[model samples]
Structures are given as structure tokens and as C-alpha cells.
Target: MRYLLAGPDDYSLKQKLSEIKLSLGDTALLADATTLFEGARVKAAEFKLTVDALPFLTPCRLVIVTGLLSRFQPAGGQVNKASRLEEADTFSAAVRAAPPTTAIILIEPELNRRNPLFAGLADILEVHEFPVLDRSGLKAWIGSRVSLCGGAIAPGAINLLAQYVGADLWALSGEIEKLRLFAGSRPITEADVKTLVGYTGEASIFNLVDAVIECRLKPAVESLEALKAGGLPAGYALSMMSRQLRLIILYLDLKSRGEKEIEIRRRLGLTADFVWRKTAAQAARFSFSRAAVAYRRLLETDLAIKTGRMEESAAVDLLVAELASGAGLETRELS
Candidate 1:
């Protein structure tokens, strides 16, 4: 059997891969019968050799290749075009001749249908494309996943979870498990979702960054406390804030260069449209000098936490206080 699983929904793709492995029977036997390769670097001859190898005390062998298909994708515009063409030819020939007892799985990002690699295999194997789910689909998926974990979620809580997490199943799946554990035997509530789901952390970290950048000292401290109360760890909160600052710095640089939002988003590899918009809005609030100072202070705080000079929780609070109060900035806007 040959399988091609391509998608942005990596969570679902991985789940499918796990299902395939589990279907192979005996977890202990998997190590023996399974072979893996980094497809981008692997030679077709080497892949064929593994695929031709007979199963060890099993009916079939499992082989997985990732990132290889991208080389053959038309829009990829991969370097070494001739090498990729030759590699695609090799793969096409080898896949057609693969042994019945070997199961080959190709995992790649979205590929063009016109690409010869996929067009050739379209009729020959099981090919599934997993795209990002829409809002309705995401909501249904969350409810189903909650039940799968032996927990029930209220509809209101479901809506709240969907609204906060968006359509990223990869993040939503993890958050669901956390909510399940936090809920225990009680039904999960909207309030519980707000408390335990990290949604508050996700939403408020941006506010905290804005408050700090704007020198709104009181709101910055309050935002940090609210995040901590919502079950976001000090280290996690600090890390998130640092990420926000870094994003702002990058956004400022890009805008200064007159780069458009779409180009900046592509450069940053940020798939979430709202995130890019939020970062842009935040970046607009700070001058380059202020953003750079905040970034430096963030690094100092991180180092202090690492060296054990300050506890993780206290370091985060102090970091917020200093940045909000403009301690490290020459401009030092006293609010």
C-alpha cells in the first residue's frame, strides 16, 4: 500500500500516521519493520532498497518519506531544478514497481495537483489532503475530540474554546486535554474554559505587551497578574511576552523597509492572519528605539532567570514593571 498525506493540519496528518503504525500490529515489532528517511536528502535507490526489504515476522513493512514531494511541486521553484526532475522520475518509476508487502507513506505540505509526482500517483494509491478546518468544522471537531478523551463539554464552553483557539487543531487538541483534566468529573463551563484553556493567556499577553510598550505601568502589571491567575506559568508568560516584543521589532524593521503586510507575513511564516494584523498594530505603537530597548531588557530578564539570580515568577513580574516604567529606555516616558 502507498499513501500520500499532505496538509497544513499536521495534527490530523500525524494522527493518520499513528493509526497506520498501530494497524501494523505489535508495537515491539514496529521498530524492526519500520524504516524512515528524510526524503529531501535521501536517494531514490536507498529508498527502494528499504522498500524491497522483506517484512520481519510481519505481513508488511512501513516506510515514511517527508519533504520530498516539495521538490517536484511546480510552484516550489526549488533550486537545482534538473536534480529535482531526475529525482521525481526516479520516485515515479520506483513507486510504480514497489513491492505489495511494503507500505510507503509520503508526508509533505500542500502540493499542486498539476505536479507530475502527485498526478502520476493519483489513481494508484490512497491520497488524502487535510486542509485547515472552517469554524463549523473546528467546533464539531473539538466536541468530538473531547468525547474521545472520555469527557463532555458544554456547548457554551465548546463555542468559547473554538473562538479562542481558532481553527488550529494542532493547538486546540492540546488545549482540549488540558481542559479535560481540569474539569475532572464536572462539566466544563465557559468560566472554566477561560481559566484553564490558556485562552486568557493567549488574549492578554498582547494587551500586556501593548501596556508595557505604551508605558501604562498599572495595566501592564495587572495584565501580568491576570495571566498568572489564569494558569499561565511565569516562564511561559515571559516567553510569550518576549515573542511579542521580538515580533514587534521585526515588524517595525519590515515596515521601515516599506514591505507590505502580505510580504511581511510570508517572510515571518505566520499563517494566522489575525496574528500578523495584531503584531502590526502593536508595532505601530513603538518607535524603533523603544522597541529595541524593550527587546534588550527582555533578553536581560531571560538571562537573569536562567542564571538563578531571580525566580521565574518574580523575574517576570519585575520584568513587566521595569519595561512598563521605562527603566531601560533613554526616552523613558513617565506615565
Candidate 2:
């Protein structure tokens, strides 16, 4: 059977690939019969030879090719169309000629539907596209993941998890497993997620933001250290901080206009009660002017890091110190 698995959702794509591998007889024999080819480097003739080769010590063989379809993408029309068509046709013909005993799986992180190769094989092969899930779909996936791990979770916990983790399935799956082990006999709750799920980054970001708002240099530095130890890159940390500051500014502005909590939450797209409450409290503590100053500093640090004016680590450290010490905020009134 010929199969085409393509999408940005690598977690699901990997799971689907594993399922296919497990379906072929014994694990050891399957490994022996499997052949992997890097589509970008592998020639069509070589791929054909491998697919046509008989299985070794197994009834069926699994042939996996990754990034094959994407290589045929026109790439803004820079590639010569005639040559691309020739190569794509060659691959398509190879795919069509695979034996019934061999399962040819072509995997791509993303594939252009208009690519000649995909257009040629779309009708014959089993094509699966794994798009990133929306909020509702993400909640369903989280619940299913928890149940699969032999654990139960409260609806509030599920909502909070979806909000904190968003659509990253790899992180979501890891968090669910951690929560499952932590909860043990009891169902996972909102508190558990608040304590564990966001600790890796989100919760720490909140803590850092709180420290910055309160002008507590010690806790802000500690939060920075925690984030660094968690293996989060400095750039990503800065981006998250910027995002939180923007949210706080928006919240304060909206609340000043007499917007109710429910309407404000909807406007901010904060669905989880835990997130909404935490953000509302932070907004209350942080004045709009303070958030604006911090956001400007964040932008400056980002520019410095991006323009090679300063190292990412040093730039982030300087930004944290400046924000925590009220260096720039001292000139402006608090409210």
C-alpha cells in the first residue's frame, strides 16, 4: 500500500507512522525489513530499487521517505518547472509501481497540494493531512490523552491545560503524562495544572511579570534563572514576556473603560478561568504606563538580540534587571 502523510502536526504524524510500523508482524523482523530514505538526497532510482527489493526474514517491508513531496514544491517559482515536473513524474511513477507486500510511506512536514508529485498520486495513495487543532479540538485531544494514560481529569483542568499548552501536541502529551503520574488515584484538577503544567514556562513568566510589577529584583532574577534552567531559549522567554505585558496593558485599558469581566475575558481570548483571573489580578497590580515602559524595553532588547548588538543571554539579563529595578519607570508616574 502507498501512503502519503503530510502536515505541520508532527506529533500526530509520528504517531500515525508508529501505528503503521507496529502493524507489520514482529518488531525485530519489521526493523530488518524497514528502509528509510531522505527524500531530498535520495534518487528516484534508488528509492525504486529499495521498494522493489524483497523483504528480509519478514513477510512485508516498510519503505519510508521523508520530505519527498516537499522537495518538488516550486518554492516561489524559483525552481525550473520543467525539471521539477520531470523529477516529480519520476517519483510518482516509482510510487505507482510499488509491490503490494511493501508499504511505501511518504512523509512531509508540509506538502503543497499543487506539487506535481502530490497531484499525480493523490487519487491512488492513502493521504493523511494533520493540521494543527483549534481550541475545541485541542480540549478533546487532551481528554483523550488523559484517558489513554489510564487517568481521569476534571473539565476545568482540561480547559486550563488547553489554554496553557495551546496546540502543541508534543508538549500536551508530555504534560498529560506528568499530570497523570502526579495525580495518581485522583482525577487531575485545575490546581494541579496551575502548579505543574505552566511551571516549565508560562507559570514562571507570570511569576517574573509579578516580580517586575512589584519591582522585586530578587524574585525576578530567580524567575529568570528558573526559565533558563528549564531549557527555554532566551528569545522565546523574551517573546513570552512581551506577550504577557501586552495582555496586561490591554486588560487595564479595557477595564478602565468599564468593561465587565466576562466581556473582557472574551475580548482577550482567555477562556480558562484560571488564566483570566490571574491576568485580571496582574492587570490590576500593573498600571498601563508601567506595562508600556516594560513593553518598550522588551522591544529594544529583541532588536538588540536580533541585530547582533548583544548576545541573547546578556540582553535578556539586562532587560530583566532594567524592568525589575524600575530604571526607566522611575521617570513616569505609576498611574
Candidate 3:
């Protein structure tokens, strides 16, 4: 009854966790029998003691630990190298001796195969890894989820959802449910998706960047407003904008060197075809001077927010206004 779930796809991992929760049945009993430990902060001794405890009014106790493997595998200077090594050895030995009635679920975003935990429990633990999906895989997953919900979707609609949603399964899952209710017995269409999904934060950030590069005041401001309404944090949006600007700079450099699409993708480690194409096109649309200026402005805005000089929302509003006003006219007065 021991499980190891590792992956970057939190949505799928959460779904697996939900399935286990459902099988346990009584909500009240689950609260009593489950013990949760954050691997980084929790001590190794506490975890082992919890695993040895008996179930409370239930047949099995659920023990979950996250980030244990990564913490054991350090990146740089070993501040507590000996302590971490001891913890890893203790965790491995404790799990191996875990009671038959305990269900231990170990979760990590990335697990080191060389870790002692894996080396020792490799034979006994049930491991599930959820990797990020490709475009085709995402399309198929969306279609399957729609079918499971007793809903239908046009092929184009499926493509559009996958494109807009990107690879965040959690966001895609929520969107699928929303689209299902919106379609209401009708097969979901491209138009339906366009109207309902609009622009996800990731997609709209591109629009915002594109608008700034083109000096399209209205669209830039509108895109920023849409992102704000969608509850995307200002810092997160700024970081994404900064990343897009950097990509545009790199794309220009690679293109200047006669690197074609494939070479550029390989150099940038961009797996998604859509991402490469969109970035290349956006980079082409803006001059290097403009891109550099935008990057600098994003840094200033980021600093201002972090230093408490401006609220996150207000900083974003100012940023949009400034980007839109590059033509020496108020963005609000633009058509």
C-alpha cells in the first residue's frame, strides 16, 4: 500500500490523489486517519513515527510526504550535508519497515533515481510519473475528458483549447468543465471556445507583448485588463513579459546567424512548435531597441512593486499605460 507519484503535471497527480481519497469513502474518517508531512520542513523522526502509528477507526492509515527526494539531492554547497544524508537513510529504512496497514504516498515534482529512497524501495513502491504532454497528447486528453463528462467537441475546438491552454492540465481541466456547461448539449465549436475561453493568461500575455511592440495602445491596455480580471498576479505577469522579451532577443540573435526554425528550436530547448513559431514571429515584429526598452521597463516596474512603492495592480496599470503611450499620446485617448 505504498505509492510514489512524481511529475511536473500537478493536475494529473492531484487527480490520482483524489481517486485515493474517494476510495477511502467517509470524509470524516479520512480527516482522522491521514497524516501529511512536508518533506523539506518536517523532521525525519516525526515522519517515521507517524508511519508506525495505527489507523484510527479505519482499516488503513494514509501517510503522504512531498519533496523528500529532491531535498536529499542537493544542488550546491552542502550546509547540512551529513544531516540530509542521515534523513535520507532514515526515510529509506523507515518506509521499508512501514506497517502493512499503512498507505504511504510519496510525491515529488522531480525524483532522483539515485536517491536512497528509490534505491531501497524501488521494488516495493507503486510509482506513477506524469510528464508534460505534447500537442497531440493534450488534444487526446481533452477529447477523452469531454467524452467522460458526456459532452462532445468539434475537432477544431479541441485544437483551439489545447493551443490556448498550453500544457497546464489543471487549467485545462477547469476549462473543459466550463466549456461543457456552456455548450449545453451542442457539440463544442471553435467559436464557442473562442467566446468562452477568450485568452488564458499565458495566451493573452503574448497579445499584451505584441500590442506593446506594435504600439497598439488599445489592444495592449485591453490585454492587460483581461489578464488582471483573470486573477493573474502582477509579479507573475511581469516575469512572463520579461521572459518573452528575452526570448525575442534570443530569437533575433539566432535568426541573424541564419539559424532556421529547427536549429532555433533545438538551441532554445523549445519543444512546442507553436511556441517557437509565435516567438519567432513576435521577435520579428519588434526591433531590438524596442525589445530592450521593454525589458528595462519591466525590471523597473518589478522593483517598484517589490519595494512597496506601488501596489501590484496599480503597477501593472502604469506599465500598460506607459507601453501604450510610447507614441506620445495617452493610451486612454487611443482608438
- Which model scores highest in lDDT? 2
TM-score of each: 0.60, 0.62, 0.62
How many times do residue backbones clash in model 2? 0
The total number of steric clashes, by the backbone 3 Å criterion, in model 3 comes to 0
Record all residue pairs in model 1 with backbone atoms less than 3 Å apart, i.e. clashing.
none
What are the per-model C-alpha RMSD values against the true structure? 12.3, 15.9, 14.8
Tens digit per residue, CA lDDT, model 2, 1-335: 78899875677988998887887778788888889887767898898898888786798999998768767763342434786789888888887888888889998766677778888899998988886575689899999999999999999999878766656677688789999999998999999998996655876787678778878898788878878888998888899999989989898788666566678899999986546655765775565777887888899899999899999999999899989999868476433
Candidate 2 regions exceeding 4 Å error are 77-80, 202-335
Q: Please report, as a residue range, the 10-residue window in candidate 3 with the lowest summed lDDT.
A: 326-335
Give each model's whole-structure lDDT.
0.77, 0.81, 0.77
Which ten contiguous residues of candidate 2 have the minimum total lDDT?
71-80
Candidate no. 2 TM-score: 0.62
Question: How do the residues 87-149 of candidate 1 rate in per-residue lDDT, one tens digit apiece?
Answer: 777887788788888888988767566666776677886888786575588889999999999
Off by over 4 Å in 3: 76-83, 200-240, 243-335
lDDT comparing candidate 2 with the true structure = 0.81
